[model samples]
Target: MTNPTALELISRSNRLGADPKNTNYAGGNTSATGTETDPVTGEEIQLLWVKGSGGDLGTLTEPGLAVLRLDRMRALTNVYPGVDREDEMVAALDYTLHGKGGAAPSIDTPMHGLVDAAHVDHLHPDAGIAIATAADGEALTGTIFGDRVVWVPWRRPGFQLGLDIAAIKDANPQATGCILGGHGITAWGDTSAACEANSLWIIDTATAYIAEHSSPEPFGAELTGFGALAEADRRAKAAALAPTLRGLVSTDSAKVGHFTDVPEVLDFLSRSEHPRLAALGTSCPDHFLRTKVKPMLLDLPADASVEDSLARLQELHEAYRADYQAYYDRNAVDGSPAIRGADPLIVLIPGVGMFSYGANKQTARVAGEFYLNAINVMRGAEGLSSYAPIDEAEKFKIEYWALEEAKLQRMPKPKPLATRVALVTGAASGIGKAIATRLAAEGACVVIADLDLAKAQAAAAEIGSADVAIGVQANVTDEAAVQASVDAALLAFGGLDLVVNNAGLSLSKSLLETTVADWDLQHNVMAKGSFLVSRAAAKVLIDQKLGGDIIYISSKNSVFAGPNNIAYSATKADQAHQVRLLAAELGEYGVKVNGINPDGVVRGSGIFAGGWGAKRAAVYGVAEDDLGKYYAQRTLLKREVLPENVANAVFVLCTSDLSHTTGLHIPVDAGVAAAFLR
Candidate 1:
């Protein structure tokens, strides 16, 4: 086979990456050596095939492997002299980019060449990293694996570092594996399968040994402050804090994904020395490349009000950026890569779970997974005594390394609505959930703004994987809450493109029997709530100078009132007119405000909750059981007008497919003749 070693390396890496306990998507790398016949020369030439950078080993294939001429690659060893081998390495990776490929091989390629074995596998197994980053790692490594493994002190991985590894292995011929202090472990053998076996053996044995020796704690036992609070208080605090946090980190250009803190994370951060421990840096360089040198640790008083927390969060944003600048200034020299913005990749909030930020959901998720893994490793290392990691100087080497940053630049372009932010009122369930789900499905980062923060969170979770949604509590009728919801959308996704007013209610009451409270309730949510949300969203859209959408969920009752539905009919009529007026005003600013009027939405709606089903059945003179079927059969197409159906109409208006069409209504009631526009 032309590159069997490449295939074998891909296979072995995938095997190691099958479980998170072994290795993460972008951590570690593997390689194998063999010879490939030169196409033109017709002579055999040595080749080294290594896993390409930023590829997940779990699903890796031969196409993802990088092949290099062994003799050419080997000749570069010890050639770069004192410090900063990045230039030489980048050039080498470029020279070795195989098969008209776009990606460079893993930066650890040169190190793999030093193994002096046919196969080499480098992995950041949970147990391996935990042990490797532990205090006095060398002695501990000696005790655990004896002479079979060699320990190399913390050294930034590059061409020179590769030479050092080879030198150490050359001297200690019997050591079949090596642990790079505060990093990860490596194993090698005569064959790919043998190397795989050695890697598993080292990781499994270390894990077992650590478990037996250390007093095991919960996964996040180290985190504390947030976990100590009452459950209800914690939920409220997290909701209050998330939006402000999202806003601070978001710039006009980029909005990072916000990860809600979990109970485990709260317990872990509750640890007394968490601030210092957090700054100790990542267990592996790969993680630092994603989460940065360390997380931005936010320590807030547990009893602080939302106003105080908001002010504090803003201040923290400024301070974090300044600190990041200082760090970059200290480490960045003449030949170093340009520095990135000061926005943090991860934020540690006391009494709340951690907030991680990334430009996109995938980037955010990768960073998050690494932090969780690091926590586990750090916890184990601390139990053994102290946790140690590479210094900031070494960390800079990995962070701005052209190879490391290039992996991101080389990523595929984002989806069209990938950068847009959206807010869906009443998103905890029903029509609101359907709209939120559709927006998220189409790649818009969404905020599930509802009265029930917990339920909003659940709805966001149910929208599916990828950190595309975050829940924010907002009573739509409350002006301040509506503003907060709008702010959350702006902050979480950078800018707002869509604001959906889907929160509504209905009650069956005759004109004479309609109570003042009933009229107030209908008008407050449908009219006042829409105005609050639209005004807030419009200011943002105008300020951003980007066209956006303000969509309202109107009702057929606006034109064709149902008997004994006086309060519902009046509000629906008022709301429909409000949408038209707003559309006319916003059209001048490129913002499209429209409405979807559906007649019979008995299913997939919160309005039908309680006795509405019974009330609706009574109005139509049908049994409660026949309500859905009756509505469906009466519709023009004999179909149920669903929440999803309403959501689809909203999607069209927001996408601007009907860019020029606004100041209108889209009927989703399956052809109600009386409700149709003149």
Candidate 2:
């Protein structure tokens, strides 16, 4: 068996784009320009050629190849929006190559250019697509190549994609090829034959797996106990789920269009078991961010009442919101605000498929995609044999993760809170500063309200050059000032989606030394101040019917009352309880209330600085630094807690990811208190 030559490998690569069984006219091309060394120095150099956009790789000839200088391609990364415009990319390619007549370069030219290898081949193989879209794609890849493969999540192909590959190359420095999720694969090597062989190997692996386990049995046979519903009954069920969904979704594009042509839609919707439909996802994870974890499961009874259906939907939505809030609060750092919202959950009418209500198209799309993919994976896994998705704790970690949250913060498309207003109290430092910074970064017009107006302004200015942060002077405990501040935030940001109640003081006075006046002061700042802010935020969160987060920064002292701090400890305890009561009462109106109880946060602001740290240190007969060391050593993880650690927890609780959590107190104490309690 003779090995294929470089020209033969290029021919095979070009032919892959034309295979209908693989990519169906999604535009693919391949190219090969022979090596070119300096004429004077005789140094080894490579001249690359890529297939033009409209030219089919299968039929591509030398004329279809666009020759270019690899050095010039590498330099384009410095240009503004270099990867954004296709024309600019092509124009840049023209500057380096000398060719009489060759096809345009492949859109993936920059990616291939980054590879140090002599030969590169790019293809969107059908088998690769199947594996990439599978439920355990990442896990599957790991099993296939232990450490040889690198996976890149889906991103629009071109300059940006090239830059991403370049970074990966720099990191790994020895990677063979890269797999782009939901897109395709690229293989490169010292020679064209090696690159082609690698590409063929990946496709062969995926193909073999698909052939062995492509089809799995369904979840279950038709419900034997419950009789199948008639066509009219199915339509009634669909109607019942639709109106509630109307309230939850912003657009009716996916809803208005009926699945008259798709038999799967009709068959699924007609089934009495509505939960089964949630198993199908659109295609990928990016889609899930727009949709949700899951869609509504509407089981329409033959004689079901509209009110009953609506009530059920409302009940589930509330439950989900509560769960989301609780997750956020638990994982949030000390001094962060709580998660709040109404209708973050969406409904998928049995017949309607999926519908979501977000502030805009991108939000709706994100929810739709997430819900779709999750459902598909869940259902597909069920077919394979009763597979359960990751647990709530794990899901919460991903959904409320700092890195994931940062991604959203970085390239915010359109969000519900993009144009919305927000007010953050205690914004001068600690958790309050974090919340203010996050909200501003996410495109919200924010008002930083604090007792120390100058400190608030300084904090705001430090975040960014933009005037997204407005510092206002207002004692959160003062009713008049609270009202005026809320008014100011609303007037400044246009509307509100969040209010962080994070102002308070703590005093470590033993019961004997704790005066009535001292207790009142602690209660006024922590408890009373929270109420004033909530009452003020309610006007906007409720009146707008837009729903919002009301986050209270309580203390871990609330959960584990330390010795000689009766006033501060009691106030924090009350704040946690208050959140539960508020969640129950305000849940009906779409307002979410939650709290964070962080332990062992270093003294920077609030009660920790106002003699409380010294007093608590005195109880242990240690200096303040020693107290930190004591707490750090006592924890299971043996890590000192930082304000940012607490800030991370607060950020998650307040974000939309934990849309279902509310009415809970999360301990952000690095497991110290939990160890003690246990």
Candidate 3:
């Protein structure tokens, strides 16, 4: 086959990266060297296209690639200021741009460019790392591939490591790849297919060899009394402890969380070797950067009761923080990024599972995933021989490396609601849907709770993936359902920070026309529902010790004294007061309660669509289509209040702009005179 183009290089990367066994998220790089017509010179020029810094290969596009002149990149070898000043090489790479540089070049660029091959792949496959981290890794590499694949000793990733690998290939002309000691593996070939095949061969051979030489109990046999809890009990215990864990972790910065109870994790946790191996921490730089230098394991056994675990968690968390701080102090030199918080990103509960935290749901989930990769590496290494990860000092150097710090600094500033999770009731449509969408856009993971399960799920999909929004079936009036919804928020995104009590209906009935059932239904859906949702949410908010928001979506009819709105008006009034009561009660816990009063949201309103719009239109002696216009004309602003307008109010009240304001009702009714707060 002809030498692969940049697109084929991306295709190969996507295939290799799609599997967790091959590489963890954003953990590897792939490149192809090809001649392209120079945009200015109209002459063929050799360019290297590789996966960009901080981008996942599976989702990589042309724009996500860094294209650099291969000649300029190779020329970096001469000017390299040795390993002591290796970091300067990263900045020096910027000068090698082929054109208007695409994505920023990753440090791994040299690994791809310096190799004398048309195609190259650098991956952190668990199997390869398992071989790499084994105490006899160099000998094992020779035995596994019989000189077909070489072994390169541990070296920090930079220009030097790249040159070292290139030298290894030069010495062993028959080698297709090399196992990176205490790291991962790299492969190269004349074509993309050949390169990919070589990578898979290394990974697959390492895996089979380990299995062939594996011990029966790699983690030193599962402890007799240490096993996972029953499924229901496990979930309950996880939910109960999540809020406190979230609170402790978020002390420095707010974090969304992800929980996993996969069998592999449970099995590893149940083993006697878990504590020792976990303490040694993960081996790969890709793994530890996300999982942290090491995981914090609950000292208690798997069989410990939830209450006991909860009581012990605080003490353990404090100890972990102290230990982490010491680690930082021991390794941090002057100008090192001031200890990026002392909290553990991965929290291990033997019987329960793992809880990982990050700035958002996807990040939190990926952290957990990286930990799982670490687990597989441990399994393979211990099964083959003693697991020998790089020393902590080396790990610390990589963790606090200036290049890593620069990468962190380059991340965009987070949105106001980043790391926050909101549950908006009645979010399947209309006002509730609008609020959910807006909050997600502002960086909050939203839970779309509605009576209609399908619609709620559909709305959530429309907003984003499971990380951004989730759908939960809830009839807000039901206490059990309400609690379940709150618990869903906790499990889905760690804990809840915002609640919009928007699940409501309108009953346009006069005092004489309204039946007792009508009053009960309206009050049950709005007033009682808001109370139920708030009560459930407050428990989490208080437990988290993270300030929260509970906004009631009341109506203008609550105080405007509109005709034919007795039941709905009374319910709205009750909802409005509940906000004040909650604000007063939850203030000590830093929970803010507020309300939004929107008047006659006719366009795209479930309440209005459910016959209320026609009833109000008939009452006002206007066509149904003209109802919004009629309502708008009456307001001082003479503008119809859209569902988006109410959503905007919720966003404002939840942001720092109103951090000191509570028990307040913002009118989203286009300047309604009668609905004005007194």
Candidate 4:
């Protein structure tokens, strides 16, 4: 069990970090000085546990906290009159670790040590940074919090900064907190609860201060004339254009993903002054590490094809990368470690949305979350007057700092499907969700396409890291929406490798009871949806001259006759035959086309979510509860056809060495001979 005080400190840290407005992804740290038994001496010694470097304080655990000897850290807190002792202080922090733990303490460990209090909390809260970055930050801090807060001017976080903090705290013995200009805020007290209270008080009071004192938005009126994509067209265009933008930023082929529609993010980007503000720079030094000192604003041509956009994006990327290196060379101090590459983490693409880049989906998500907060702070500071943070020279030291770079340099190598991209339709539930999840697990970036945008997003969130699964709203029958879905796959991941056509519906009715509407619903969704998605996917596949896979989810009724299932049977048969022809046309381009015929899959699937299972069971003269077992008993193998069973078959078709096998149907009905092909 964690010590009660330590637990409170961690609890406070996590709660603060959980909100991006407070601490954007791994941006803040916390520490608590407590007594612990020495490993060799077996005597109680004061130990300081600051948040470990590079880990998100929001999700931090016991081991994630770095334990340091408090006395040793305090010894290094004072900068000897004025020599360059930053390097020596960093080494001292390393030497002070009390035991076997190798996790490095946060860069601000020494400052936390000199707090002379039981708890110390440092956070880059949005409101705090907004106030800190403003031209009149010092004046505002005094006006907002009065005598309780000490204002520390802009300084590199090192021994000097620690000395300054210690000196200020000594001078103002009654102050409860200190605001680090162009950086963040620190609050300390005798107890964890007291320090946390002070932190909240500071944030709340400053937020209120800004709300009342800040000037009116400068560009609010100019937004009326901004050239932008229509809301109806943004999703499709964003999807289509994603690949080109991704290709521009990709160093190798790890698929780049775009995250859009976060309410706050959208609200910020919609501001007409965003381009100008973003170009100014990040509000905090840590954000400079997440995004960059210079923001890359990508222009989307009004009417450009995927090919044309890719060409244009390539040119932009080259210029952006070169400019980044020049900025780095200009500001990099001697002994600062070289960054891996000059790729921008968050790139602004007005009229569509800003995109966050990283090696994997999670890192990209961090970039997006962090940038959203940074933008809010930027807009807030600008409203207060003009946005200005630590300039490029100050930001350079933080971005390329040896300690910060070590965190990102720790990720392992990518897996097999790291470069591949896939689109799964009807992915909100059941079979489609299973297939999409499997694809993500195998390292393929997946686009979750469904009729309901919310459900699609929820399904994607459930599958894996938010970046790997993108939700796209597409009604397959609509040619435009289908084209958009295809574009979404290419645009988001830079290329396409697999297309899973699983969006479908069925109507239960007798020959006389079957209305034309019922027939159209089934036919349009099954036959036409597959046709549209396949047609769209095939064009992209053929254009690249790269092999791909198109897997269609058909029904067992295609080959096996069922009572009161005419519409489903006929349209499914249409799909089965269409797959054969698609194989013939697409096979020349090495794009394999195959079909899976699955039996009843009722558990937690959308097919049953709307009472379709109960209605279908009634038609079959079986109780709703017995529907799955009743269907299983009729099959020779007497096994229920789970959604995962169908997913496994689809995976085999897409990934198996049966490269020459196409235009064939794989049955997922537990040995139902009637559905078997001759």
Name the top lDDT candidate: 3
| Model 3 lDDT per residue over 158-218, tens place | 8998898889899989999999999999999998899999999999998899888989899
Candidate closest to the true structure, highest TM-score: 3
- The whole-model lDDT of each prediction reads 0.77, 0.60, 0.91, 0.78
Instruction: Give the Å error, residue 316, model 3.
Output: 0.8
User: lDDT: which is higher, 1 or 2?
Assistant: 1
Report residue 659 deviation for candidate 3 (angstroms): 0.5
Can you give the TM-score per candidate against the true fold? 0.72, 0.42, 0.98, 0.75
Q: How would you order the candidates by TM-score, starting with the best?
A: 3, 4, 1, 2
- Rank by lDDT (best first): 3, 4, 1, 2
Residues 1-678 of candidate 2 have per-residue lDDT tens digits of 111333564476555655543332323444344556656678755567666544556666556566676666667766737533543674576676654566655446777666565676666564555455555666766666555667776665566777786687568766776667655667666666676677777777666655566444343444432333455554445433443344443222212111111234434444543454454333332333344445545565434566676677667666656665665666666533334242344555443344444543234433443343344443443443333343444444434434345444555465434644568888888767877777666666678888998998888788764336678888977998987787655433334567777887777778999899998998998889888888877765664555667877787777774688888888887888889888997887777888877776765655567666777788888897677777778777788776767666666776678888889677777776542422
| lDDT tens digits, residue span 171-226, model 1 | 98888888888788888899877888889889988888888787565233444233
| Worst 10 contiguous positions by lDDT, candidate 3 | 1-10
Where does candidate 4 clash, by residue pair?
242-491, 243-491
